[model samples]
Target: MSLTSVFNIAGTGMSAQSTRLNTISSNIANAETVSSSIDQTYRARHPVFATVFQNAQGGNNGSLFADKDQSGAGVQVMGIVEDQSSLMARYEPNHPAANEAGYVYYPNVNVVEEMADMISASRAFQTNVEMMNTAKQMMQRVLTLGQ
Candidate 1:
């Protein structure tokens, strides 16, 4: 793939990871949020991504044992989805959001999971940045060779 294409691919990766990190931050920020009902609870969100492929004619390998054709370009974000898992319920009778049964519902987000996701997303973003930087350096080196 061309150096420019490498930059594009890494850029997409960085963007995707940024979205992931944002979602995780939202989740963690709302981890302790209490709600009067299930419908009012904050939902955890995640970003979806898809691969961009080019036909073999353009240079895409499209093979089982090899890297796919990245020359065509990078990837794209499909969407962000909310996790639909069950929310947590706790018995806090004096709480403002407590139900008739003294149970208050909270978001299903777990602090531990959110922390892990944050770390993972941050690392992925850094990796993409490094990849882009490496690609830039390689391109600069190639120019020096020509001069």
Candidate 2:
């Protein structure tokens, strides 16, 4: 891989991590939200990521389906998916948002897990930033090779 491609790889990594962090924050924010109906409850959201690959042989290896010619390029966020787990139902008859059966539905978001994911995403983003900065320094030093 070329030195310039490092920038693209790191940029994509940062972008993916940013998306992950956003979803984690959203999930954490809605962790305590309560609703009368299950449908109205906020569901924990998670981002889906996929690795992007590029064909090294001019984008194709002269075959209809070429896997050997592909190389890892960067990461990409595919989409956001909601948690399928059941929502927390509390028998809080005194709550304002309680249902007719005296049950309040809370979101499926787990604050502890969300916080851990946030920390991981933050570190990944910082790592990507460091990688980009290192690439920039390397490129700059190459310019001083003749001096």
Which one wins on TM-score? Answer: 2
My TM-score estimates for the predictions, one after another, are 0.85, 0.91
In candidate 2, what are the lDDT values of residues 1-32, reduced to their tens digit? 67998998999999999999989988988889
The parts of candidate 1 lying over 4 Å away from their true place are 55-72
Q: Model 1 over residues 1-147: C-alpha lDDT tens digits?
A: 556878878888888888888888888888889987888889888888887665533655444534732344566789999999999899999998898999998888888988988888899889989998998899889999967
Clash pairs, candidate 1, are 60-69
The local lDDT score (0 to 100) that residue 48 gets in candidate 1 is: 88
**Model 2 lDDT on a 0 to 1 scale:** 0.89
